[model samples]
Target: MQIDPSATSHPALPFEYDVCVDRLPDIVTRETESAVRSGAIPTFVSTDGKTWVSYVDLFINMGQGRRLRDPASAFFVSPEAMRRISYSSDQIDAAGPDLSERNKVTLAGAKRIAATLAQLRKDLPPWPYDLRVPWSEDFDFPLAAFIKAGQLDAYPSGRCWWVRSVEATKLLPIGESFDDPASPWFVGPHGRADHAEVVRLSAAHRRHWPEIYGPALTPRVR
Candidate 1:
């Protein structure tokens, strides 16, 4: 959907904090494209709207909390928006499998949501596989399942997903799941696969302070 031009200027109850939420799906879509094109890690914002960081900054040897917090980092919103957008953009356009019938299942009440969860439980791939990095193959099904099952909320700008369980904020963890050589979850600067720079910096620190920065600070070459 087209973003409201005034969304950039105004701040409302939920969408007030960031341009990402104010613009909703549109800004997220554009930002996803930008992040991909620029070879930067996808963005992740916490449900409470209090924290955000790029995957590279969060996981790699890079110092924590160093990257900018914004939607330009995340791909789809939570699973709900992800499904709807997939239905309209991929399904309707015949570019991907059509979940038309599945999409019609309303998440209005708890019962319906539960039923949807049941269907998703059967359809989704098993864990570990489901927890793979977003850019990996077969990632969407498990992610959609998690959202429907009230395990994850990926909405841009940090608003909680509509279908998540109350305890999800505490139970479910978001972001990269595993380390893969093909698509390493944590990369060096600018999301590059090589961690040489991170290693070099750590080595330099070790050389300077042999006792202080010891083995704990050693960079893992993934």
Candidate 2:
């Protein structure tokens, strides 16, 4: 759908804010595309409309607060708007199969936005596979499963998938899952397999982290 040009100057909200409560999905859908297309940035406005980063940011990044100004502006959705998309903020990592309500809103919005943007700009990067990143034969199924679970967050940006790396202790754990390369669960920055895939396979189950990726306890070890 085409963005309504009339919405350009949001009347009521602050200059920093983009879309408001009443028109979140459509306006956000448009803005997300602009970010990927023309590079427009966004910020989540607070419930009071006085604050820049909404309470939603706290729910993401393990309450450490999101990086609002740099890297890229996160969708500045208000709590009221957040309700339109999801319910909670609990996460498996910085991002994962089940993202919080705010995150779900952001991601779903990105998929629609990016898909549309890709069509308009041929120069925009295509899917990751076309970049010659060397995928394992079995990559498709689990990756599809992950996408189906709504966990993958690498959006269609100009370069590689924009995997938003978060604090080491949060989503996408910082350390190696297994020290032994012979183990099936080994994970690191540069593994024999795809790094993101290895991380996803070994760490997607955040709630069960202690039980997973432990080679000695792994079934593969036996």
Candidate 3:
């Protein structure tokens, strides 16, 4: 599988390949792209089963300013359950020893996400999936869960708590040269669509599936 050179424009943000492959709906793609360009930040917008939850791959360009890199997460926001937890009056430490330093979180953002999830609990008849950051907002721990832990800070209010989870990281595929097998993104006998290494590639070389390579996505047995 190879990316269609003729079918793409410069992927300014990650997951732009998602838009090209029809895994992400056109409406959601357009809306997310618009918000990212405007600097609101890539967000977990919505989903209709056509694709997973939509988010942006944000980056700070050298001179252009804060913008999304070309790409979106390939993993679907897991359609799982969430438990509501409240921090004790005596705040606990937030940052878990396991959490990484590649990213940071804010107390306010943590609170906000917690509140959002709480509201979603009340609003949605059934909890959809775990509320995930647009990207690796915090792969390891959900920000709200660690609020009382003092992982972020003791700030009471007027601050947004944001966590960069190290557990999961989704990035925009920056199409670097990968014609060589040495390249992590190289397409070869093992180039399954869902391969973690393949997903990391900035390009979706899906021009030929089942023929040159097996289906990146498993085809319906039927």
Candidate 4:
């Protein structure tokens, strides 16, 4: 994406960074713009359409373990998720990365993300933040498994939000199917109620599912 440095806003804190959308796919652009128009916060976009970033990326990055394999996945955070996380629209700021520097994915980016997590540890202190390694396991949700299942309905803002009925937690073997109601991983009636409660109560829970599961989750063909 062509980044226009002059039009960006820079926030003062560590998790803060600019969001430029000039390089995003057309679907992403449309989804993001619709979210903004429907009362969601308007994240900073470069006047030159070269840079863009969103609060969801920053929020996920704040956690202990996070990575972006598919940058397009950032859009999974819906407007409701943003409100649930208590992120303020006014908190967004735009800033420019060193444009002259040729952008290349390097170990340095990974290290920087790790370092940022380390600093967050010292600055925030980990009382409220509990760190645990995630596991890889598959789970099923027949109600919403079909690609078109939930796409027909619009969110409160008249935008369609992809619905996923079942998901695997961070702990389980990779590629394992848990769609059978009898699977231990299935969210059962007598399972640890607290765990299920946390999942239901938090948007971050869904956003970071892959991290919670070390491997990709596969849908069951029930």
Candidate 5:
């Protein structure tokens, strides 16, 4: 189904906040490594050669004060960990996989948004100075998933996938510190967020691409 443009002005209810984390255990890595040696992909690697395994734990505060323990809601594997299990091509291929028919539909909806963003970028200027670095790459799946689940909100426009308005009280604990190579939290400086800046830049994206964005706004989660 196509997204309606007029809905842009209609605001959804505020999102609730809670915390999230990465919960892969040591044993899982050992088992995974054994499998990798036996021909599986060894995506997990320690930054410092001495350490054989890498794991991460993050603190994510969903809008609500609660913290989650479920892997889906609280914990996420590091991209590096994921790489150990599969290749980038495979990961990209698995992006929108077979699932409940509803999920398939959701995936299609997301693809539409992705396409819109791709086109919008061609016409827009770089994100504002403060946001330029982090906004360089296209939005990632985790963030997109959060937006799809109504955990986050974005304003799209003819020019870009602008404005990312997250719940104020929420704090997402992205594991892997920038300083630690082995840590899953090591998203480069250009990968992190300056919340306020993202919001302001998103507004700019909206202003520029209003028309294309108009037909693309849909409920976060059907």
Candidate 6:
């Protein structure tokens, strides 16, 4: 979205539209217009511990959207399966002359992700979790499997990981110019009733599932 007209208030951050949309649950977006501000939510740390990246950026980059392949390729190996296979830099060098430099780098990065995921999985159970399921901080979500190796990183669920991104975190829908029903971001003042509506709508739109969009668009009568 064209630098949100509320730029003076929402001041932009370094993230892109899709990243912001994907990680909507992690951000606080329903505050008053004057209170809504832009910032980063540090979610993941680099394996080396020297740098960090937000969930949105990392999620999009690591086989989720735009930056990588679709989340359905054989690449997104399960965390359990990923943890099973050991990864090492030597594995790249030993790949021989046939392996291109780009592929070698990807392999090395995969090793890092595998290591990180292995460490994360230590605190959780060995079961496939759905990314589409409602997220809760109280529960340990399977982040490692969200997007792996350019795939939605699924088990038997067959759900997708890379959901659609939105143009804005919050839309006032206050004026005729700003209130366009055709726009997916359109949220009347009454929209405040359900803060998560934006995310639900975006995901449904991204998946092209009219069934979901239809129900979500039905106005709440509270």
Across residues 98-187, which tens digit of lDDT does each residue of candidate 2 receive?
Answer: 555543444344343333222323332222321111234455322233333557544443322323232111332344333344433233
Q: How close is candidate 3 to the true structure, as a TM-score?
A: 0.20
Model 6 residue 82 lDDT score: 14
User: What's the TM for model 1?
Assistant: 0.19
lDDT of 4: 0.31
Candidate 3, which ten residues in sequence have the lowest lDDT sum?
58-67
Give per-residue lDDT, candidate 6, residue 106.
Answer: 45
* Model 5 TM-score relative to the real fold: 0.19
Query: How many residue-pair clashes does candidate 6 contain?
Result: 5
Candidate 3 lDDT by residue in tens digits, 166-207:
221222135532224564433222111122222222122222
Off by over 4 Å in 1: 1-22, 25-72, 76-108, 131-222
Off by over 4 Å in 4: 1-17, 47-51, 55-68, 71-222
TM-score of every candidate: 0.19, 0.17, 0.20, 0.25, 0.19, 0.21
lDDT of 5 by residue, 24-132 (tens): 4454434444544665321222233222321211111111111122355322343433212111111112233554443344334334433434443343333331111
Which residue runs does candidate 5 get wrong by more than 4 Å? Answer: 1-140, 157-187, 191-222
Every candidate's lDDT: 0.30, 0.31, 0.28, 0.31, 0.31, 0.28
Q: How would you encode candidate 4's per-residue C-alpha lDDT over 1-222 as one tens digit per residue?
A: 222233323322122223444444455556555655664533544344443444433433322122122344543333322221122222111133542322222122223444433343333312222222112236333322332354322121112122222222333346543333555434322111122212222333223222222234211111
Error of 4 at 146 (Å): 19
**CA deviation > 4 Å runs, candidate 3:** 1-23, 40-99, 102-112, 119-222
Worst 10 residues of 5 by lDDT: 12-21
Alpha carbon lDDT at 196, candidate 4: 24
lDDT of 1 by residue, 122-171 (tens): 33233212122132233432334566565565332122122222323243
